[model samples]
Target: MHDPIWQAEKKKILTRLSIAIYKMTDEQLISLLHLFKDLNLKDNDKLLEMPHSHADGVVAARDRQLLIARFFLLINQLSEADLLKFMNRYEQKRFSMLREYPRVPCNITLDLAADGRAINCSAMDISAGGMFVESCESFTMNQPVSICFSLAEDQLALKIKGRVIRLEQGGIGIQYESLTKYQIEIMKNMIDRLQRQASSQYRIG
Candidate 1:
């Protein structure tokens, strides 16, 4: 019941499935991806009664291999139209709008507690999640860093704790960590209003 080989084989099957889907025409590709999705969602429904193993404890490994190869060949031609429809439906539901927020050049100071390094950087963008500060130096990934940045004036300045989630050529990605209830409330209201305006514009377009 606790066989590692079976797990490896299953992984191989899924990998093959992904490769196959990427190779199909748009319509055929959509159908193949849908099959996997259905398998995940309707496993208990017994849609396709495919035999997994023989009575003699022998797996039909050869047949499964051929089927995997064929699936890959068919998936090579999936249509872009079908791909866009699927993506739009999924992404739009998850994110209310796909608009990028307007970013103005602003100077911000960052103090990293790990090294006691103080650096001045320009902000690339700002959203409720966090802001991207343009810097050439890379910070430790997943490192907790203290950031004290002023916006507009000292009245709207933010002193927040954040974690560095990613590092890239331009700058590091930060996710905000520390904030008082009042700060969070203010940010949420601002973000909701901005997103609503963006969503309205998206609909008009």
Candidate 2:
């Protein structure tokens, strides 16, 4: 087991990432949970290619049930892109954002233009490709909607026109309009830097 201080720091970091982080879909969140569990099971700090043998049975026994429930809960709360971004960040812990840029979570206020209906929401996760936003308002699945938000540092304000791909309690899933080449470049750079830093630190420590 890691030392008390180390464990505390790890939990603290995870908690901070949870709150400040963007959204994640149910499928993505389950994958992340599995990743965390797998990382923890590594004895020498090297990530395992598969789950440990000892726990393999347990993992397989209830995999379907666990996935269905977990996925439902995540859909109720997180967004797809946010989910992907956080999973990437968690997988690349303790890296410099400059060398490894963390996915920037967007906090957006969505407005329904038809009647000026609006709600305050934020991403559960984000990537240059797309993002997931948690909403209090529910919409029919595959319904088209208008979205607006800024990228990191509020530098780039984007008004995207997209559709709701999935729907659940408290929110609906959206796939944003396609991103520009520049945005994709920025996201990839950030992810690469963070991943390298995480791997290096894990090796040294």
**Which of the numbered candidates is closest to the native, going by highest TM-score?**
1
The digit string of per-residue lDDT tens for model 2 on 81-154 reads 44445456565643332233344444444443212556557766554445577766656765666666554455
Model 2 CA deviation exceeding 4 Å by range: 1-116, 186-205
Against the reference, the lDDT scores of all candidates come to 0.51, 0.49
lDDT of 1 by residue, 1-205 (tens): 2368755754565565474333322223233434534324333333233435444333354744554455444333323443334444434532542243233233445543435777776655555446676787768886777776544354666676777777888887776653444555555565566567668888999
Report how far off residue 84 is in candidate 1 (Å). 27
What CA RMSD would candidate 1 show?
Answer: 15.6
State every prediction's TM-score relative to the real structure. 0.40, 0.36
Q: What is the C-alpha RMSD of each candidate to the true structure, in Å?
A: 15.6, 15.6
